[model samples]
Target chain A: GESVGLHLPTLSVQEGDNSIINCAYSNSASDYFIWYKQESGKGPQFIIDIRSNMDKRQGQRVTVLLNKTVKHLSLQIAATQPGDSAVYFCAENRNNDMRFGAGTRLTVKP
Target chain B: GAGVSQTPSNKVTEKGKYVELRCDPISGHTALYWYRQSLGQGPEFLIYFQGTGAADDSGLPNDRFFAVRPEGSVSTLKIQRTERGDSAVYLCASSLNPGGHETQYFGPGTRLLVL
Candidate 1:
């Protein structure tokens, strides 16, 4: 009985604004999590990942926050741009099986 | 360096036919995984290989779906009696694992359509 899902299915943001996508996972034993961005007809590109040992990890223009107590994960994109428009997914890797949340579509408007 | 790659970016076939999807993981990546993504849904795990052996095949939907990694570099997922429901984007991912600390890189994926 394990599932990973996002809180929102779609999000709209203006260029230069910030965007936040949230995910909730049912497995408390999941120790590793990742964020992926998939553009149309492209693969899910690796954005950032956070281990259970760390609460936060940052990358170029992106940040991933993990809250183990609540089994919640969130990805924050700074200065969101048109290029950032895509579907974002959060995944939990446990027991060598990676489980992905449905996804959140982010549209960047001019 | 080249990223993980899948062959035949797209494939269309008739129902009840058979198809093969191939994945070439990044060089030196010890772990490879396969997933299926439907329209508007996240990719679901199908299988994983550790080196030349299949460490996990539990996620495969049924016996008709099979995957293998020989020589531990390339993998092929074979489907028998392919059905319309099997039409989806098949994804492959590779990760350089240093124990639990790892990040998975995905390939473009093969978009399969059953007619």
Candidate 2:
């Protein structure tokens, strides 16, 4: 019954601007969360991950924030570029299995 | 050799047909996973293999779906009596360890279309 979901189904942002995508998970026992980017016709690529023990984690130009109390997760991309345009997914790791969210389609327009 | 590779980048089969998808993980990786991705949706976990044995296959939808990793390396996912709903992209991933927390490297995935 564990499921990961997102707040926004799609998001459009201007190039060079910051973008924030949110996700919600249904499992409290999940110990780890990850973010992935999938371009069309390609598999999902690992972006960054955060442990339940940590509230925030940063990688490259992206930052993942976890709020355990509300079971909410967020991914922030600084100065987003056109190449950042893709479907971003949030995944929760529980019982050695990873469940992915419905994903948010991020469109960065020039 | 560097990343996971799936065979037959695309497959089209009719209903009630049997199809086998193959996945070759990165060398020396100890864990492999299979997932199904429907149109406009995120990937759904189908099964997980640790070494040569399947650690978890509870995610497999029904008896029509099965997979095997005999030598702890290459894997094959078999589906019997496939239906229209079986159409989806099958993804395979591998990690260095069998733990829940590890960076998974994914393949390009095989697109299956059941007509």
Candidate 3:
């Protein structure tokens, strides 16, 4: 079926280490992609976004990489901290409709 | 300015009952959307409101699920004859418009538990 999925369901990283979460999208028409972090009992908070025209976008401590040729997206968090522990989701947009992936649970162990 | 807000952070109802969840968008936001999040799953789009009208309701599960945005600022999601399967976290988000550049600010969400 057509959907977005992550390569890993959960990822654990040591404090101060770098963490990378991968996502695969099936829709070739997706023009934009965004990464969001959702703490327990809270809604998803926007992290960073990238468009198909660009291959990489960097935020404060996060970076989003898009490979339109492979239909893959990646989110990299540098110097992961305990406060960053949450479920991270990758969303893809085609036209104005957005679709989300199952999400990757990120746990930063201190 | 404050972000989006939702009423009744938690609600519990029995099966076959009716329930309504409300969402108040940020000031000036013209696009509102409703999504449902199941355990360990991503938020699934339920409906979208552009201004005061429903622009796309293709994500609605069935006739029992309905949503309306009367004045373009606040919206409500109504579930008729709710079933246990309807239990999930209902989330509301608002954006400047239904475009890619506008960030979608989300509310805390209303956790609905159907017994």
Candidate 4:
């Protein structure tokens, strides 16, 4: 896979701290949203997802918050680790159509 | 179970050339998708297939890009008269089904470079 987020904005976080990545979706009709993590040389992997009916969803150490009014979504990673260093993406889906946002680069430092 | 697999992990072609990229989806997965990713950007959806039929292809940039999944498992994305802008990592993903927004498992994409 291509290495993404080379020139995108980056967020640096210390290990053991929490990191938040945000995204603004384009479609108001989008009902399903998903967060993905892509490490260098690997394809995007599913992290967490939320639907318009729900404001929040939690996975192991990750949480997804959806604000439908503003079309905003965010992923919160608690106790971030070096293994979490990667580019994060938010995607919106409606009627089987999914659109991804430009990713945010997360660099976790020890 | 084997994950999605793509062939020719890397490909470099000349402008105006034609190329084909292959994808073998996970066994028994009924939903398949194609996406193109450029540097600094997220993977853009290119096409989606349900069974052996293309369910959606609105994401395809133009007619120059075409895909086929006749057997409902193996897919091939074909590009004609390639341009520099067409160079990117082509990713393939598959899920159990299309509804309910099932998680899509992706393969290490095919890196295409048009010189």
Candidate 5:
């Protein structure tokens, strides 16, 4: 069985500060990892992804780190803004199927 | 240029009733997926379609859930004898192909409320 889980259910950070959301997966065979941001009344939006062969991938202000050795994944948002407030999820893709974590609600305070 | 679109943005049905949710993927997309998201939870995979056939449906909770992607363009998810537990946001996503590495573009989703 494959399970993806997040360390923090909710996180609050001051605007302009860096935000990091952590995720842990049980399947060591998993290869692909993706990060998504979902706002209220909307579907999950793809942010970035990292493959098992890669340890890190960056896009714009977001970076995804994948540690296959520990089955850990993380999404880092730099200079977070109020609009960045949303529920962030990490999904592990294995065999063309993706398993998502519970999600971490990120709140950026003014 | 339009993203994926879902019909009946919101659906309210009673227990034991049947419900069908529709999803229109982006043009030229060869892979489509269905997911269910409960309150305060991340979206859970329900099914995936490559072209007109179901590539994988292992995520379906039970026999009560079914989906189809005829013509390899549009897909419909059918729920039989819906239960209160069936209430959730039904999300549809599509990628360029069946490749596991492609990014999946999602729709707004259809909110299903089974009373």
Candidate 6:
């Protein structure tokens, strides 16, 4: 079955440093990709998204890079803060059905 | 202005019991979605609704799981003969349109425990 997966399960970064999370997807037909952040006991919050046609999309302190040929996607957070500590997930949309990755826990140290 | 909202923030049920989870989508949004997230995992797509009808139900695990959106605003997910494996956080999201590229706003989610 086609799935989205993350390269690491946990990441720790110091405050004010940059953090990057990587994801690999197996479905080639997926056209849309999204990043979500889930805090403890809460649902996923939309971070950013990018389409297959675009290689990169930037948000406030957040950036999403997509590599269609490599079936890879990444989320970069600048000046990591303690509030940024949470589980991050990447999802791919195929035929309006979105498939999500297992998720990577990001821990920001003060 | 308001995002999606779910009812009964938490639910605990015994095996063989039936339960219903409710979701109130954002005002004027025409698309709704249901997902399940287990421990240490991302939300798994369960179903999607466009307006008053279900547009995609392929993610439903089995017949015991059912959902309905009668008024195109509030949707309900029903689980029958619940098992312990059914325990998870059920999330609801809504989007302005029914497409893969549209942004979907999510709710806090309903936590269910089958005991």
Interface RMSD of each: 3.5, 3.3, 3.3, 2.0, 3.2, 3.3
Report the lDDT tens digits of candidate 6 across residue range B5-108: 99989999999999999999999999999999887778899999999999999889999999999989999999999999999999999999998898888999
- Expressed as tens digits, the lDDT of each residue in A1-110 for candidate 5 is 12244344888999999999999987998888899999999999989999899999999999988888788999999999999999888999887789888888899999
lDDT of 1 by residue, A33-105 (tens): 9999999999999889999999999999999999999999999999999999999999997867788888888
In candidate 4, the second chain superimposes onto the true chain B with a TM-score of 0.97
Model 4 RMSD vs true structure: 2.8
Off by over 4 Å in 6: A1-8
User: On a 0 to 100 scale, what is the lDDT of residue A56 in model 6?
Assistant: 95
lDDT of each residue in A1-110, candidate 4, tens digit only:
22345678689999999999989999999988999999988889888888899999999999999998998899999999999999999999887788888888999999
Alpha carbon deviation, residue A45, candidate 1 (Å): 0.3
Off by over 4 Å in 2: A1-8
**Global fold similarity of model 3 (TM-score):** 0.95
Model 1 DockQ (Cα-based): 0.54
lDDT for each residue of candidate 4 in B1-115, tens digit (9 for 90 to 100): 5899999899999999999999999999999999999988889899999999999999999999999999889999999999999999999999989874688889999999999
lDDT of each: 0.90, 0.93, 0.90, 0.91, 0.92, 0.92
Best DockQ among the predictions, by candidate number: 4
lDDT measured at residue B31 in model 5 versus the true structure, 0 to 100: 96
User: Per-residue lDDT for A1-110 in model 3, tens only?
Assistant: 12244243889999999999999987999888989899999999999989889999999999999999899999999999999999999999775577888899999999
Q: What is the lDDT of residue A64 in candidate 5?
A: 88
| Rank by DockQ (best first) | 4, 6, 2, 5, 1, 3
Give the DockQ (2 decimals) of all models: 0.54, 0.56, 0.52, 0.63, 0.55, 0.57
Candidate 2, RMSD to the unseen true structure: 2.6
Query: Distance (Å) between predicted and true CA of B37, model 1?
Result: 0.4
Candidate 4 chain B lDDT trough over 10 residues, lowest sum? B96-105
TM-score of each: 0.94, 0.95, 0.95, 0.95, 0.94, 0.95
Considering the two chains of model 2, state its CAPRI-style docking category. medium
For model 2, residues B1-115, the per-residue Cα lDDT tens digits are 9899999899999999999999999999999999999887889999999999999999999999999999999999999999999999999999999898887889999999999
Clash pairs for candidate 1: none
- In angstroms, how far off is B112's CA in candidate 2? 0.3
